[model samples]
Target: MISEKNKSNRAKQQTNHTAGRTSFVRLRQIRSESDEHLIDFFKEVRWSKKKGKFVTPATEEKHNEMVAKYSKLEPEKQTKDVVASIFREVLGHRPGYARGLGEMVIPESSRQNTVEKFAALTERAERHEKDAEYYKNQLEELGGNVEKVLAKQAEYDKLLSSYMESQRQTQGESHRETQGPA
Candidate 1:
């Protein structure tokens, strides 16, 4: 026969294991639901918004045309903004909002669109890097110019010092001459 303490310990262990399993299942279910929502949103954006243009269309003119077309659609038909607003609303419900850098909630319809938008943002960022490189080169050119100016100023300073010393010596000689036999 087992002691009461042993039985209690075994019961506790079992409870812990069961609790762990339950938590794991809950997490898995949440992830799956999130994924399903994302895929649905992606499909909506791909087929309904851009007419199945998986990648964003070229040129701002084309993009604006697509956005205008998307905006004209009904709420149920709206892919980006509606979904984004819904996602924002859900994220607002999270307690972490009070703290800085909280995790955002993804609306079922906006998740995929958000992901694709992220990709677009990254592409735009790369373009900005080209601009950054241009600025960097400009900075280097300016630095070279500043160095040249400093060197010229140093040369002028040396010349000014030598001229002042000669003037001092001439004044001393004239003082001696004026004294006459001093």
Candidate 2:
């Protein structure tokens, strides 16, 4: 009972809806790629999905206001050192702190110290490994010796039992002769 014209219009609408969804997905992909670049640029910052914003120390203005407030305090209460301390407390430390502390220093001594410590640790590990292998070999040798001793003891037990049986038979015969045919 559907009209031919209405059916063609519905088909056209479905095609448009699908195309719209495809375009929206592509847009999202492009946005996400840009977001990745932004995240890389702001290493110490994080994206807050709940607030829909980025949180970073560099982007904050509160620190400047706080510094000004602290600077205006009574001379006894606030000094240059006090302001610097407040700034340090507010900013804590950034990822570039170490790099900024020594701009281009190679820190060769520390690197050499670390390498020496690592080499010492590796050598100790190898020594312990060798000791473990030696102990394992010694254990195996002890086990083999124990097995040999047990086998020899079993043979000795068999021989002793045979000798005791022969002695008992000889003793029985002698007792019978001495008793005169019991």
Candidate 3:
């Protein structure tokens, strides 16, 4: 029931769409290539034909966490590949979507490594805050006088150095001390 002119126009449109679009890679291909640990990730993404959307069972916090973790994975891990595929699968090759997905996933490092580094950094920051609080309390206790605080600090440093000096006896001094009044 279509005219040749309309059919030609449709073909032209299809060609244009196909030219610009990168369809989602099939899941079978992804499964074969993906690591065993990512099986949980696979289970998280599902398509809903009736709703025409993905049925991710993640709460907002969980989804954001997953995005963060996935972003930090190496480019070679097929993480982005899986993300792109799922993205296109759910959203389709949307018209004019050529931004390259560059900053969407910020790569910090491998997840375990990044997490450990983050933990260490966080612990350091907490320790620094505690030290700052202690120093602030000490300064306040010095009656808000900068000179007094500096003097106290200098006194503490002198005392600490004196203790250190006593602990480190020269060989000659030790020998003289042991020989005593000879």
Candidate 4:
């Protein structure tokens, strides 16, 4: 027979596990719905081989021209806006938008700044990790208490690991932002 405490813990664990799976399933459903909308939007547009871009029907003439040009080709042959839309929508990129005389563009500068910041942060993290190692070695050479030195080294290791993991997660998020829904 299980104790009341054990039963409660098991119930709590099962509830947490179920909640996680439920949230994951909900997220998947939302993504699927979003993908369907994107597909439908893309289907209404036509690709221009000559212009080498996906062309939405801004005008009837443009639409007719695109239809005539790409009708012979398969849908696979048509230039898909999946990548472009990903950049525009998910990554918040606006290729067509420009400031007066191109003095400043928010999207372009934002992307560049983000990349630069990430690079700087990664470099700083690497430097800090090296510095931590040097300090650990110096403490050992100076005959510091072994347990204290080891504990400090462990903390440094944990910090570096967390920093690297965060960096990886940031990179993954940016990569995903530039990728179309899947």
Candidate 5:
């Protein structure tokens, strides 16, 4: 039931296709692709149709070129590149390379690392909350009279700093006198 054109197309597709599957199917290819294979795809590909936005044929060539070059990379370089791509956004600013900032695809590997980091951050925030509550309860137990004590504490801190500064100046002058002008 296959027409000649269909047969020719199938034959063409079967040969030199990256994985015996033509690039016709989109995101599904990403899932079946190897770990090393996806880094370039993530680099070049973005959301097509994007809820009625135009599809770009531009990234296909870039993707193909990256894939071709990827096989030549040393294993260390490959890992470094994959890691840089995966974690670049959270670490700092880089204009357009961050994960959530643009349409760049996030690697599946980042999930656990991201979750662990977020867990630490939330734990610190919770500790701060608990500390604040403890301080509030302690203040309430002492008739909530905190302003005068806090003001005196601030004055004490300033006086302590001034005293330390004067002591440092005195020691520095004595040491300089002993040195007798470098």
Candidate 6:
């Protein structure tokens, strides 16, 4: 049988260990909360878990091309929504786990607050319709410029054809006149 004194000493040791773990956890939580890169770290890890979703050089190039091609589009494309969507798709339906350090449960109020904030963002996006229309008009003007260039080219083609035909006729008439009424 273990002696009472030894048992008490073990209990004391366990208590110290528990206190150490508790303080460590609190410090970690504070660090995570205050670290600006925490969200970025989470996002990077989550998306990188998917093979092709992570940004590669080729993907970056393609994104740049798309951005350039659609430069006139209103409401700049933000990767935040895409990254958040990835997280939701991956984790939103997963079972809740709050047992240990790894398990995290977002409070219902916090979730509701996030939803409200996103709702406001959606409203702001809706309000940007006029700006989007303006961009569409700019795109239409570029198309119109292309059409004008095509029309001008066609007009020049017709003028050249007429001028060539007139020249040919004048040369023939001059040759015939020089032949002295052949």
Tens-digit lDDT string for candidate 5 (96-158): 344322335343477798999999999999999999999989988776467768888999999
Residue-wise lDDT of candidate 4 within 1-182, one digit each (tens)? 46988887665431111122334334334555554332233323234445654443332343344345545566785554533343234323445442111213334346788899999999999999999999999988777577778999999999999999999999999999899588
Candidate 1 RMSD to the correct structure: 17.9
Per-candidate TM equals 0.39, 0.40, 0.23, 0.22, 0.29, 0.35
What order do candidates take by TM-score, descending?
2, 1, 6, 5, 3, 4
- State the lDDT of candidate 3 residue by residue for 39-122, as single tens digits: 233323333445554444332333454456656667786565676554444333544341222123333347798889999999
Quote the positional error of residue 109 for candidate 5 in Å.
7.7
Q: What's the residue-level lDDT of 61 in candidate 6? A: 40
Candidate 6: what lDDT?
0.53
**Tens digits of per-residue lDDT for model 1, 133-181:** 9999999999999999999999999999999999999999998899988
For model 2, where is the 10-residue window of minimal lDDT? 13-22
Query: Which residue pairs come into collision in candidate 5?
Result: none
Q: How do the residues 1-182 of candidate 6 rate in per-residue lDDT, one tens digit apiece?
A: 56988897665521121123344335446656553232243323323343545334433343344344334445555354443343344323345532122235443356788899999999999879878999999999999999999999999999999999999999999999999974
Which is the better candidate, 4 or 5, if ranked by lDDT? 5
Decide which is better by lDDT, 5 or 6.
Answer: 5
Off by over 4 Å in 4: 1-109, 144-182
Taken over the whole model, the C-alpha lDDT of each candidate is 0.52, 0.54, 0.52, 0.51, 0.55, 0.53
Candidate 3 TM-score, true structure as reference: 0.23
Q: Tens-digit lDDT track for model 2 on 1-182?
A: 46988888665531111122334334334555553321122222333445655343333343344446665789798654565455445435433342211223222246788899999999999999999999999999999999999999999999999999999999999999999964
Candidate 6 Cα deviation (angstroms), residue 46? 39
- Name the top lDDT candidate: 5
